[model samples]
Target chain A: MSQLKTKHLLGIKNLDREDIELIFQTAANFKEVINRPIKKVPSLRDVTVANVFFENSTRTKLSFELAEKRLSADVINFSASGSSVKKGETLLDTVNNILAMKVDMVVMRHSSPGAPHFLAKHIDANIINAGDGTHEHPTQALLDSFSIQETCGQVEGKKVVIVGDILHSRVALSNIFALQTLGAEVMVCGPATLLPKHIRELGVKVETDIKKALEWCDVANILRIQLERQQMKYFPSLREYSNYFGVNKQLLDSLKKEITIMHPGPINRGVEITSDVADSDHSIILQQVENGVAIRMAVLYLLAGVT
Target chain B: MQKRLLFDSPLLKVTISRLCQQLIEVHGDFSQSVIIGMQPRGIYLAERIKEELESLVAKDIHLGYLDTTFHRDDFRRRDEPITPSQTKIPFLIENKNVILVDDVLFTGRTVRAALDAMNTFGRPAKVELLVLIDRLYSRHIPVEANYVGRKVNTIQSQKVLVELDEKQKEDHIWLITKEE
Candidate 1:
């Protein structure tokens, strides 16, 4: 029996080295289980999980749902589009009502930063922060780290460079913390405006040169240029962004060593990464998606396993 | 920890030889069979048995490993997360005699979980349990090993420890009693 010190998986910052290691080790098991002929496990048969997405999602929602189903958990999905939240219902009220239905766990993806954290303090049921604003997507970081380790052998002593949208990307924040905790030398590379003001405070080297970063890194977790979250034009145009920070095959091949490419997708293909580079053997984007389910399964399994 | 000596090295070698002879008599070259060891400690015992069997029968046997962490009934009710091990049942068990090997058989919960785990890799024609030591009267699910090395009477608080020559310096068995 391996117990996590924290009750809720709110952020990567809240988790220690052992917590991350345990999650990865557990995810390794689930990864094996998912690859089997019969993918489903009877670990969470009696447990019920509620996925409360206050924002729109394609991958995270489906990945969490698949993970819940594979664990044999009773899944009740509550998207804001069809929920009481659209009817001016309070976050607490809606979640409390769901808890009244005997849901044992809540997997939430909110648009507001600290939304899941606030809910975790109030809710009796365990909360897994799917993606909360520009805060932290712990599971995404976990899966990304897991995928990196799976590909490059280990995260320790490896150079991991996160390219594009560091300021607005929750994945960047989480990945930086996770990779650093696992002893990976982490770097943030993007346009100066897209990078956070206090980005260096996160203990990651800030690299504006994509080629330099890519050349140094063993794994490059490229983030999609967030067009939706932009309030104003941070950069001149999409074309300019692509010209400057975009990862393409030509630039990758010029490097001495082949680096593993990753993207938390809905990729602006030509903008951050080209289609050819994304589909190349060096790219592990699909593996990241596959590892996402395993990582989420590990989180749900461990959290639910707690008596 | 207080330890009482049970079967020692010489007795262990004889018992293992006897077990292999019995398996040879029953399985007969083991063409339609696969041996799966319940991990993590069971693997050592399974390897030793496979070694003994191969030397006696003059043929290689299919050996697999199973981890029952995810298939356990007490999964969600446990105090902490159950760390699962490698479950490498490479060959299909469909319509084959599957031998579930373990170091010890006590409450039978592990064997029950192994059965559940085995169901994923297609249905076997038949399944049998083989244990190095079977503690009598401790059965929780009425599981009886077809091939057992030794049968011992144990109290509720007592524990059985089987150390193989592959890992330990010497092959030995110990019945451990807790301090008051």
Candidate 2:
């Protein structure tokens, strides 16, 4: 299985173990390429990609743009804030307009779930779902798993606990799918209100206690508490949430063994995780950022081969 | 399919030594030169040559592996997806002579891609091609190896296979022709 099975990267749920392995293997090569003096490649030189973000993003957007540029693809970024979407242009119309301009690929992030899937059915170009509301961020999960594999030697059999709001986090959802597919034991640790009702149906262990979850896992992937997505309060307050569920150096140090730490960024320094733990030696937060580029490159490169 | 032995183990060993000798004669201790092997199959030849050259010249010759999967012109055109190997060039090629090594030079496309791949790692003072098997009259691009092991005339249906093994005695080069 040298090639990816699917044409578009809509979600990790659509991928099998072989696809994930191929992406990681290819990403390993891209990782080496990005570390070189000249970090750019001519692979996607003839391909044009449009980064159509229906929502705002910082790291994912920058990472995708950097990955596209490094692959030598011509990129045009579109955000919803100032776009024709504000003028009541439909999603299909906006994408069709971009496609008419001869765009070969679209990396889209929409506020609604399955937006990329919707566009995939209508558009001829390849569609990479950057983030579709609370659905999934495939690249983030891939890079997170890649980082784990890089650090701990493998993702198989390792205990990885995702610590934070799982309901509103596309990162958590994608991470669970990717980690499980790669044969890792996954556990979601957060307050009861933040976790979705049927999260156990996804086959991951659920734990409301942060310390017990920390003690049981080899790696902890801390997620940000999305205040913007919360219309009503899930937890009492930020201070109380931090008091119960926050991961700090004291909590980590209290563990029986030193476990690897991870956080998909825009980290709440003292809210979900403290400054010391975020910047600690156990943290692979920064490496995740770097791996994001390589993972995205591997995805774009592989999908470009589909036609 | 028909297979013909182009070079046996003994011949391969002698050819490699001769190639290393020619390299030593030109590079002269390789103080300002680096050997870069094209990825996938080329690294084996590059490793063998680097080992032979170091022992012959009694100098540590810097060697690197380069993958041209990203630079290939036939990228979306090929039926099978091109998988990239690792590119491990630790040192910069600035103002240094680069000897690009490969096992087979057939369509000249891999070498062309290698040329583009090598350019990313600074500008080399001089770049030279070294191939174990040169498939004559089969180039799609203008690429000629500086050090050629054996030039064998081949048709479009013919393929050159250079097998370099850990056990040096098992090394053999074969010309395979597809029979319809």
Candidate 3:
């Protein structure tokens, strides 16, 4: 239990309950480190990390970079838009070039599913999946769970309902694995077309009614409707989707108990959740962002011990 | 393996009292001074020392716990994974005399890491080291302690164990050696 069970954090599916707990424990320490007057440590001073993003990202990319820098590790960022990735260069070729520069780890976000998994099989360095298509965003899910544990004292036996475009979200998939592993009850509530056909096989309760879902859960994690990923309209319109599934302040106020609200951002404000609910005291959206850095720091630090 | 008692309970008590007397003489009233205990093992010794010092001076003293796991030199080079403890410094160390406390000072690496970790709080007016047991001739670094309870000559592969009981009567320091 001193080190991670796996060398790389490919996804939540690859991690067990103990691994998640270890990350949370380690992240707790890093949380203190980040809050200090001098919010930096030299644990990874000699190690170099390369953030290779094949897809566009804002928060995840920035969070990973900030986490790497806070650990005092050397960081090199690469996005597909400006890099040689646009000129017909392959994923392995780009990563191999970065590895050639003595990178010890790679934090990657790719548009294709299992890209990090593929790179892990070929590369010698550690791989952390930032986000891979609709596959899994391991760190995001870890941070979400960590935030839940921080707010609720623990994730065990808590009911968490994820409401949004579940079919196209890497966040929902990873969250289901992570929350379930930590002994939380999970439910996915969205339009029937937005939910995968076999999502019930994953052991989460499916509820299409947002009201019923909110009433049954202790926490409601609202997700954005990703228009970029949608090839065709899964729902009739954004207004229709929000009317049905969006978690508003009025909806939360009507609940028997005040359930914690969460959203993994680039939030389409007023779409998945209204401005009032997003800024409400019940929401932990900002805490989730802050915890992301610590969680990533813990992941990098723990994985660094393996090699 | 063999265990040899270095300091029994009575001797340990006398040593702690003597260390407190020396600290009192130098930093009268301890107005501008603070005590920090290194994490994991050093905290118990630090707590005992702080309690004893408070009772002697009849004044409150600032004490903090610092964990240097993130500043260690052997981070990726160590055989075992390094787990971090809590660093809870409620008061500022800026322009204050800071005394770093640890039970055993071995290769001087932990102290070195502690010094580095202390800088994150604020620059101290003066920094000093206090150790209950100093393993002489074994330091990998050039750092030395300002206050030493006892110095014992030791070789590699030997271990020094400090067991401090809550009630103080069962406290013991042992030198563990491998049997040939």
Better DockQ candidate (1, 2): 1
DockQ, per model, reads 0.79, 0.75, 0.69
**Clash-forming residue pairs, model 2:** none
CA lDDT of every candidate? 0.91, 0.94, 0.94
Q: In candidate 3 chain A, where is summed lDDT lowest over 10 consecutive residues?
A: A1-10
Model 1 RMSD to the real structure?
Answer: 1.3
Task: Report the lDDT tens digits of candidate 3 across residue range A175-270.
Answer: 999999999999999999999999999999999999999999999899989999999989898999989988888888898899999999989998
TM-score of chain B of each: 0.94, 0.97, 0.98
lDDT winner between 1 and 2, please give it.
Answer: 2
Q: Give the per-residue Cα lDDT of candidate 2 at B173.
A: 82
Which structure is stronger by DockQ: 2 or 3? 2
Give candidate 1 regions above 4 Å deviation. B167-169
Alpha-carbon RMSD to native, per candidate? 1.3, 1.0, 1.1
What are the chain A TM-scores for all the models, listed individually?
A: 0.98, 0.99, 0.99
